[model samples]
Target: MAEILTLTALGDNYIYLIVGAGDAVVVDPGDAGPVLLALKGNGLRLVAALVTHHHGDHTAGLAQLKAATGCRIYGPDSRCISPLDHLVRDGDLIDLPVGFVRVIATPGHTRTSVCYFLPQTEGGPPSQPAANARCTRPCPADVRPTTGPALFTGDTLFTAGCGRLFECDAAAMHRSLAKIAALPDETLIYPGHDYAVEDYMFTLSIDPHNQAAQQALRHLRDAQAQGRPIVPTPLAMEKRTNLFLRTDDPPLAAALGIRTDDPATVLAAVRRRKDAFQPS
Candidate 1:
């Protein structure tokens, strides 16, 4: 089983270090300094680095980490980002020390954006569904254990929100989100940025009376006040509160004054509204 270590880098970006099995893998190393320190602190050897997209914030540390640790870099085939050691696409499985990662293409924020899905493996702390029903499992004192399958969503999907469309259209983004929504509800989501508080606040603006969204926003506010991370949210909770995931709901159409039947149309309208929406 792989133990995931969350390291905050570049202000809001999160870099994950997966240790266990026999080797270690780092995902989206935005800075070489923090990643190197974390590896040394844990006495772990870096064997590989997984990249979810070509975004500089996600790949800026790739070259440095690769040089220092000789870790192989894996990312999309797009030329916009740094050269990758291994070009990955949809459905490709990459092996690591603890567990293997299944590559899922989720292009919307960028044409080459992708997400890494790690299946649940035995080894970490016992599953604590109640505690982690809304946020990522807290790191244990010792080496963390595998809780279950975790999704490393790089700017494609955030808690209660989604990424800006820089490369694809609303229809494409809707399709990509549908793929993630189809995953088992228990799947844990590790977003690239710590945007839960802001995103949840935005949700409240659009869905003022939504009990689930309201309660979730309150819980997130408390977590923030306590300096607790609001990420690694459960997919189940996201399904309940994420406005982007509810493009098909009739209420969304009514609220946005859009057609109800076509998911893509509703999604497009919502995205446009969000782009211009100023959170009060």
Candidate 2:
């Protein structure tokens, strides 16, 4: 029984709540108000907080959350918030009942950017095609593994689009992304923002005829129409479609004038295009 909850925050930001084994951890509390409210709604306790970076959008709620939940805070010392309970770095492993949660020190998006790779069973991809006759197209079984991890990518990888490279160069960001992209394709992703609307738009811009992205958009449309958020994107889907993660794709790299193996160059070109792109 693995449960990952998402709390809406300022604008596009999200506060993640994960019940890990015996403890509960919240990753990247963008703001306190919603977190507090969400905790109340879930009837779950918050044991600690994992901050991926030091941006205020990610840490602004720390002080208030601490006051409210009394949870210990852990983050990169580089982006230290006062009263830092614990500090972890690259190659650090945190024990949780779900399994040994490995801390992947992924920098570039930020100097201290980190992603939690929890190697537990992914419940399943949201049953996209079902009784709905119009949506009954089956997803590839080998492509989307229903059981695996949850990548808490804070402001780094979105549902479709990647994050804006603010602190690191495009090269570094691309490298960090490549590392995650190399993970098992079925690993589910829990990004720090809800950018599905705009992400699908960009997907259309770069790969206008991308069948996968278009299918996802349709699934999302059905979900939203039913008043639900389309999230927990499968890593397989990201690999197949996200330009940032798919820079390794032969056709995608060719489009960017880069070798599929050259993550840095492909990333730089993608970053430039993303900068100039306006979702149509």
**CA deviation > 4 Å runs, candidate 1:** 121-144
Poorly placed runs, candidate 2 (over 4 Å): 20-23, 97-99, 122-147, 257-261
Candidate 2 — number of clashing residue pairs? 2
**Which one is best on lDDT?**
1
- Model 1, 1-280: lDDT tens per residue? 5667777889988888877844779889888888887776667799998898878899999889888989888888648667578899899988766577999999888888999999994433343323323223333212334586789998899888889999999889999999999987878888889877777777777788888888877887886686655657778889988888998899888888775688888888877877887766
Looking at model 2, the pairs that clash are: 122-148, 185-236
For residues 153-185, what per-residue lDDT tens digits would candidate 2 score against the true structure?
A: 887788987878878887778778878888887
Candidate 2: RMSD over Cα atoms? 6.2
In terms of TM-score, the best-performing candidate is: 1
